[model samples]
Target chain A: MLQSIIPLAVDALANAALIFFVAVGLTLVFSVLRILNVAHGSFYSIGAYVAASVGLWIVGAGLPDWLTFPALLLSAAFVAALFGPIVEKTLVSWTYGKSEAVQVLVTFGLFLILEDLQRIVFGIQSVYQDTPMTMLGISEIGGIVYLNYQLLLIGLAGVVLVALRLFITRSRTGRLLAAVVADREVSEALGIDTQRMFMIAFTLGVFLAAIGGAMATPTTGVAPGLGADTMVLAFAVAAIGGLGQVEGAAIASIIVATAKVLAIYFAPSLDAVAPYLVMLAVLLVKPYGLFGSGSTRKI
Target chain B: MAHRTSIKTLLAATALVTSASVAVAQDKPASLDVGVFTFMSGPAAAYGMPGRQGAEVVIDMINAAGGIDGVPISATFVDEGQGAEGVISEYRRLAEEPETDFMIAALSSGNCLALAPIADQMEMPTVGWNCDSHQLFADAEHPYFFRPNGNTIAEFMAYVIYFLDNNPDVERVAIINPDYSFGHDAAEIVKASLAAFKPEVEIVAELFPKLGSSTYQTEVSRLSAARPDVIFSNLWGGDLENFVRQAAPRGLFRQSQAVFALGESSMNNVDMPEGVIVGVLGDGWWRSPDAAELGAPEFAEAYQTKFEKAPVFPAMKMANAFMVMKAGYEKAIEANGGAWPTDEQLTAAMEGMTIDTLTGSMTFRADNDGIVDQVVGMVGSVEGIEGPVLTNMVRYDGDAVLPPEGEDPMAWIASLTPDFIAAMPKPGSYE
Candidate 1:
């Protein structure tokens, strides 16, 4: 029984690690900007494509394999730096103070354009670069061989969670963003540049999502429709966690991933719908979400 | 006045007879318009693009050689990545054209099943280039739709027989296939074959991952924990490549006797360790001795020159489809006294016809399902080959493995015995 349970737990955590990155980023964006960025998933896929291309180039050029590690981080940073500010300024900011329906439509249109752009640039075939994964090697856990890279992902997820919590609590920019989240009107009246805060928050959100996608390239294939899949899962996690709670996103990621893994193990037929099933049940009880309050604003 | 009216009636009768005679003898067209459906984009394109490229090579070859009855083949390519509804809409749009001659449609079994009836309704002659589902003809008859590369029963059964021959003592088995009709049908066939051939073998785990899934880590771990002696998968295209990449690192290949039914397609794209069981699903192997003798080498050369890569099984299959189509045209023309044949005449010509393909010979059965040999082998390092090549190969006779006409396929598989397999050809026996 213990033997069986160990693999399930490990697999669940590893799965959760990937989901948490996108989920947390999504929650952060909604918390600050108060807009559901439907295009958030595009940044994730772009990051993955960029990371895969750069990593493949590095290896193909006979560069040192360790460089792929930094390449992953740099790839995410590049996607966030390139897409985040520009998108927020040009398209995302235009929907400010508009209806939610308008924001969603605008962002959904952006998502479609980005998806097409990716196809034009990257082509439709899947891209794979696993040098980083191979470099880390494998380990035997619970009598099942596991990728060391997968374990690294679990640790990285934890590190990001801690770092994100501290940044939101301790850093100056974090405080300003939190202030905007708390009361945007009041913060603007108190001399805080809400526009700049929204940009920072949105950029940070993109960075989180991109890093998640970058880290995932070692263990998965990067393909054309990846953004849609990621976006749906992130939405599920965000909904289950409540729209604006970071810690809730972390918990919700675990719940969703565990549901998926468990379904794969015990009921393979239900694997595709397991996460959504859990979300449906959760929402039936907690209408707002696990962490949401009707009137209170918390980040 | 009565005499004048009689003369006018006689002239009108003569004109009607002349027009009827002209319609009876079909006029040769300026060009033969063909609608070729394949996946030109998405992860499936990893498999579908080669089929498209193969069509181009074959079409170019046929047109260069003066085409079928001297009519140049003008192909309109439809991407199946657009989903079934879009594919059907495209098919209808193409079929509505007065000049459309043929359709080589559908790389997916589901799409094939969807379009088969439509082909009949439209009375259009369409050949399934890569549709491998046996169910395509099991329940219904589609006189207009024909598959020349056989079906999934022969394909998956070949793997089971080959694997059991190599590992007679194996007790446990598992399957991880794409979650679709192709995968489910394969699982049923494999399970039925195993139950008949080796009743004691326990099926430890059966997983059907969604198609185009980027990650298979959780599924891999589940497979690892189950620890089956043999792991059989028919995952193809980018999904198969992804599985191989992720599973290879986690030592799944090293742990189990992995049998990738569609492994040959991804050999050049990914690193599959030596000794892993792989096959081309049918006799679509470009390097087989029979294929080498059947002009596959020249076709492969042309493919390499144009695509910068050797033709994979899908390409070979697509090339074979074109050959079958061209042969049908020739047979129809011969039967029509060297004139252009109508659609019904073409269908009649293709019925029960046998023709040599680029890789092997395919014979259309009474039901329009094809009979083609099944080729199975293992990945091995050769002295001159740049990548892993198939070694220890066996060619299973198509007729021997295919169920008899009008019989339930699964029931026929269930009736098989160990003695049946014992009498079949052994590994490396086809060299």
Candidate 2:
């Protein structure tokens, strides 16, 4: 039992690490921008595609293998830098003061366009670059062999959580973003440039989602529908974590991952619906989620 | 001013066409129009794009060789990732347009089933390039729909017989297949085959994960926990690739013997670990002895040159589908005294026809199911090859696994005795 538990925990943490990045980014965007980026998942897939492309290029060019590690991060940053401001300024900015329905519809349209763009750019084949995974090597934990890259991901998720907390509480830009989230009209009245904050928040959201996708590419193969699948899962995590709660997303990711892992271990039939089942159970118990409440914004 | 000019431009174009038509009498278009359907998006595209690429190569080859009856074949490919309803809508839209003579309809069994009835209604005389499900012809037979690949029953039962021969001492088995009718039906056939061959065997675990699922971490854990002697999966395309990737790192292969029915299709794309059981659903392996013997080396070399990788089973299947199409046309033309046969004549020619493919001979059964050999083998590293390849292979006869005509497959398996296994060929016999 102990041997099995160790591997299960490791698997759960690895699963949660990927889920946390996408979900927290989604929640953060919702909190500050006050509009759900239905296209957030597209950024994830785009990040993966960029990372795989870069890694493949590095390999094809006969460059040093160690460069693959940096390629992952560079790929995520490239996607965030390229897509973030353009999408936010040109398209997402229009949804700033619009209704939720309009925001969703517009972003969904963007998702469709981005999906087609990926097909045109990457073609309709599964792209994989596991050089980073292989480079990190393997370790035995709890009687089961695991990729060290997976363990690094869990640690990275922890660092991101701490770094985000510090940014929101201790940093000037973070304070301005929080002010905008609290009261957009008041922030504008104070001449705080809430529009800029919305752009920054949305861009940061794209960065986080892209990083999640980049990190996941080492373990999971990237394909055409990856963005949509990630989007649906991220939505579930965000909803269960209380739409705009960063900490809620963190806890909810673990909860959802644990549920899925448990279902896979014990009842294989429920593996697919395990996360939603947990969400249903939790939502039934707490209408606003565990950490989510209609009060001052919390993590 | 621009709008008026555009209208005047349209009138000028109409005048130019009228003058050109008068100058040259009636002539057929330079290229034959075909609407090809396969997966071009999503996880299924991992399998479908290869089919599309094969079509591109074969169509080019045909056009280069002066095409069929001297008409160049040009295709408009449709992505099956857009769900069945969209597929039906696209099929209807394409059918309504003139110039689409034949269709290689789908790769998904569900989509093929959906399109089969509609093909009959439209009188399109479509060919199913990769439809493996037996249920497509269960109750209703579509006159215009034809399959030149054997059904799921034949494919899955071949695995069962091969495994039984290879591991005569095996007692426990487990299945982890995609969560759909294809997966479930495969499980049923495998179980039935086992029950018929060795009733003492116990099924310890059966898992069905959703299609397009990226992570199989939990599935690996479950299958590991079960500790069955043998683990079987029909997860194909990206799902199979994902499972193999996840499971390889976790030591699942070291713990239990694994059987991936569609593993051969992914041998070159992924690093499939050594010693796992793998097979092409039909005899579509480009390097199979039959393929090597029957002028398939040229096709294989051309495919590799064009696609940058060796042709997998899906590519072979797609190429074979074109071959079948070409054969049917030739037979129809011959029967019609060297003239273009109507769609009806082509359909008649395809009925119960036997055509030799690159890998093996395929004979379409009266029930619209094609009978083809099933090749099963274990993965091993080849010295000269860049990656792992199948070794210790067994080629199961198609008729050995197929249910008798006009009989329910499940019922037939239930009535079989241990004598059936005793009579079947053993592993490595084909070589």
TM-score of chain B of each: 0.96, 0.92
Per-residue C-alpha lDDT of model 2 across residues A53-80, encoded as one tens digit per residue: 8998999999999998898888888888
Docking class of predicted structure 1: high
What would the per-residue lDDT of candidate 2 be over residues B1-431, giving only the tens digit for each residue? 99999999999999999876543332344666778899988898888888998888888788888898787888999989899999999999887777777889889999999999989998887889998898988888888898888789989888887788887889999999999999999999999889888999999889998999988876776677677888989999999999998888778888888999999888777888888899888888777788888656778788889878877888889988888888887787788767666777888988898989878899988877788988888888767877777788878788888888778989998998878877877766765
Give fnat for candidate 1.
0.83
C-alpha lDDT (0 to 100) for residue A19 of candidate 2? 92
Regions of model 1 farther than 4 Å from truth: B1-23
Q: Model 2's DockQ? A: 0.52
Q: CA lDDT of each candidate? A: 0.93, 0.86
Leading candidate by lDDT: 1
lDDT of 2 at B51: 92
Report the C-alpha lDDT of model 1 over A1-299, residue by residue, as the tens digit. 99888899999999999999999999999999999999999989999999999999999999999999999999999999998899999999999999999999999999999999999999888888989999999998889889999999999999999999999999999999889999999999999999999999999999999999999998777888899889999999999999999999999999999999999999999999999999999999997789987798789
| DockQ, every prediction | 0.84, 0.52
